[model samples]
Target: MTWSSALKKTARDGLTIERTRLEPLLALRGAAGVAIVVGLLLAFGTPKLAVSSAFGAFAAGVATFQRTWRPRVTLAVVVAVGLGASTFLGYLAAPHHAVFVALLAVWTLLAGMAWAVGPVSGLVATQTIAVMLVTVTLPTSVVGAAHHAALIVFGGLVQALLVVLVPIRRWGRQRDALADALAAEADYARRLRHDPTARFDPQPLMDARDAAELTRRQARYRPGQLAGPRGVAERLRPVLASLADPVLGAPAEGPERDRVRDLLGAAATVLDAVARAIRRGEPVRLPPEAMAVLEVPESGPLLSGPARRSALRLIALLGDVVEASDEPVRTTGPATEQERRDLLRPSVPRLVPVALRAVRREARWSSPIARHAVRVSAVSCAGYLLAAGLPLGHGYWAPMTSVMVMRPDFARTYERGVARFAGTLVGVGVGGVVTAFLHPGVYVSAALAVLCIGLLYLLMRTGYSVTSACIGAYVVFLLGIAGEGWSQTVQARLALTLLGGLLAMAAYAVFPAWETPRLRDRLAGWLRANGEYALAVLAVYARPAERKARRVREALLDSRAARREWEDASARARKEPVRHRGLSRSAERAAEAALATMGRVTMLMEAHLPDRQAAASPGAEEFASALRAALPDAIAAIRERARPDWSGPRRALAEWQRREGDTGVAVRGAELLTDALDELSEGLAAPRRGRAGRGAGRG
Candidate 1:
């Protein structure tokens, strides 16, 4: 991609307004919490105190919208505690410019590194720094600072308490996550009826796994419908693929293939019902047609041996899903070890060390997170100093805009910069009109600010532009309590916002951590993960054991994560203006396709994994060894931009094919996998061949 094209694409991305589901009830609850905190403060204290404390309430409410695995109350409390701590520290540092700038650099740096944990953690951390930048001006002395901090903490606690007492859609996140996974598989099954080789995105299943993790306390109240179905949906994916694969289960054009398609359709319907049941917290309503399809005898000649077995397994898993839906919610008893293990979350206080450790690990220069930290820190400090040097009174707005808008990637940083500036402009314009025309008193200003906050919550998911507009009005009305009218804010706010946004974009353009340069590394990592999955499954066949079963499960998870990483890199790289250094766009696409094909073949083999007490598959040991040895070399070849050799696997595959006489499902899948690898080798070699041909012509 060229720079011009990249800019054009990012501009459209920035301007694009997504259509999100309307959550009026949830939005109202969040806004009501903010109103409660502000109202109580105004009744007991001054208007300034209420306005300052509103930051904590607003931030806590925003935390609930984060897409994290943590409970809503936990997130709210954690965010509140951070707000209080940041307020105390910021107040102490505000009196001295030097101390404050130093603190800003360090705080923003940590906030940048927080991305290493996840986006939610990073967003929460950055929001604290932005809030600190604004609220520090509210406190005058040490005692005053403590009082302000306590009030902020009180506001957050109020929000958290509302989460507990009101409890809109209790355990809603868990149910939705589990239901989404089933829904994804249902969709996949429907797609496979037409495209037998359709690839399944593992994101939903991964989300389901994350949702299933529960603390002992949480587990005691676990809803039974959420349980059992997660694992069943997970195991069903491979069997569905296996049953649909022409090489594994059916003829390319025959009655068996038709039956396979029909089975997939029925599976999709059944799974969809289960998903709806789980989502609605109702009993499983099995569709009559799907039940009839499942009840069909597997003794027919349409499917034989392993094919028939896959069909039976699919039905059994579907039955398990239906049975589990009827289970009553469990309200008592100790959580199982399987439910608690590493999935058990530490309390918020203990979580700080874990977060700190993760940030420290990403502090090295090679980490993109570290580079982002450096970028934000420098941009924030520069924006603040520049704003201060000029006549812009509220200099914090500059650095606050930079901090909130900047992200780790070029696309987001640039897109958000443009979006934030435009949003703030529109936001301030509306706010100026309201204050100039209405001239609301202190109580009315508070009411208008609360209304703005409510709209901010309501429109948050619509797009950043809409939310930014509301935030603009919110700030205007909020500071009105301190007697800063529209005239004082109109000029300074818009100018400083533009300055900060420009600074953030320039910082990224000058020091970008381009994903294009690392495309080969990402591809190699994916290849290694794919090989590990294939080898794990083959090892189970070579020598079945309970340990290998666990290994296979772990490998499957690792491979899915790796696949997501590669896909993300590819997507980011395409948007980047930087030229691909080692891997061309065509080669990248082909390599990804080949890898996906190989993965599907491996999954088909895994669908018929031998029982622990059963005899090992013939020649499984040789094939596993050969494939295992080839993977490291293949990964190395990928990194070097050379053709990968898989002769050993090919030899073993041929021998196994001949030994198996009739060519079993595993042997056939292995042949397909090797064919996919051959395609991968050709893809990696094409760029080299192109360059060589050009060199020869020049010579």
Candidate 2:
């Protein structure tokens, strides 16, 4: 696709705003949790001591607000441990500037590299850094540090209790995930009903299923329990995949086709209804008409073919799910019970081994996350020194901003820096007016803190700007409760925040990992995967008895995943400031065209039911070999920036087509596929020896 067309497609399907009704409930829960913790501390202890309690509550609220109880427990444990360590580190290093900078740098490096594992691990590590920096100003000896640490743990415990005791929506995240997966399947089926040759992207549905499964595993439900909607959703997944097949979806047009479409349409409606009912914890109530659509005659003019047979099976599956609503929950464990038991049994210590393994895995010099970690550590250390040397009141804010704004990619880092600075400025202005005018007491300040924190949680996913603004307001009210004046705090924070943003931007400038350089490898990977998938499909036609349906399916999935990765890489590369001039636009277009043609070839191969006799057709194996060889040459040509001859593959395809008794569809698919290969080869024949081009920026 051209740049303009790609942008339009992205606007249509890429940027989606998810509207979750439970945001209000989550916000309320987070606020109430903080309020309860603060209220108890004020009732039992002095106002000054309540600061520790507030910190604890805030940590717990942030950690477990959206997670289920089981993950909540683990996350709470980690937060408490990290908070304790942070307090100790701060206390130990605060007495000496040199010692503090050294320790902070080490922590920042480790925390930044933790991002390699995943987003959750990254969050935990970053939060630990934030807590340590924020609490470094507290006057604490060894004994006092231990006391503060205990209070922080107590605060997290209180938050956990609030979540467990006052959940607004039971299993909300899990239910929503499952509901979304089912809903996506229904949508895909609906599309197939209208157009058999429609292109289906499996990533969204797969992602939903993966999320739901993760939630189910983490939940503290009874072992092997698959109750209510969870079980139904799992059973529906494989059925939905089969229904999406072109062969089943596009039957011969007549009364049979009409009946099949009607059944499918009704089934999609029923699935949607079930998804909603699952989300709301309501009873499943299929309309009477929906059931009647499933009662078509087995031998009538509308129901006597393979298509009707498949439709009957689908209807029967739906009926069984509805009729068997009252049975005990059926568990489909990922592994056998014995295996789970064996793995969990006590053995020799493995913690050190696992830790070493992970370290070795992420220690590579070429790894993006590792390079980013180094950048963060260097910038953080520099920001700290700059802040301390200046007249800034709080030296930690600059380092904190530097750490928070920097992400794995250039675009995200710059975007986040802009959002953080703007949000903090607005927050400081609004907070200054409120604190100076109202001069609220401890109770009122705590209430405001709760409200602001609630807003912060509510807006975090929607937009970084709003979330940052809420965070700023929250910090102001929290300072009020801690007896710090807003006017003094706001100015210092603003200066430090700007410094931090600048430091983040400067770090990226000095040590860049631009995506443009990686596009060649990404495209090559995609071509190789598609080649393997096409070869696998063709191999089935070459030797019918050796064809494995499972292998073919796996190959298709791999190809699709590779294609997605390449597309994402291309988009990110486009956002970079420069592109390799050697990689011309024509080459990019040809690469995409080749992949499109490959898809059509795969589809034709999938639709054809090859017999054992067809395997003996002259030059069939030679044709398959030629197509397989062409893909590597194409990929090599792109990488080396040199053209290869395409005549060999084209001639092989033509010879195979002229051979006696080959199916028309197979011959046509080969011809089109070879033509695409010719185009791709021609596009990549030029050598790389030109100045770089300025990338066309993304919207």
Best-performing candidate as measured by TM-score:
1
Task: For residues 515-616, write the lDDT of model 2, one tens digit per residue.
Answer: 667766777787787777777777776677676776766676677778888777777666555556456555676666667556645654554536555654
Per-candidate TM-score against the hidden true structure: 0.96, 0.80
Candidate 2 — what's its lDDT? 0.67
lDDT (10s digit) by residue, model 1, range 333-434: 667676557467666667779888887888788888999999999998898889888876888889899999999988888788877888889989999999
Residue-level lDDT for 638 in candidate 1: 85
Clashing pairs in 2: 643-685
Error of 1 at 513 (Å): 1.1
**Any runs in candidate 1 off by more than 4 Å, and if so which?**
298-301, 330-332, 338-342, 545-547, 692-699
Best by lDDT: 1
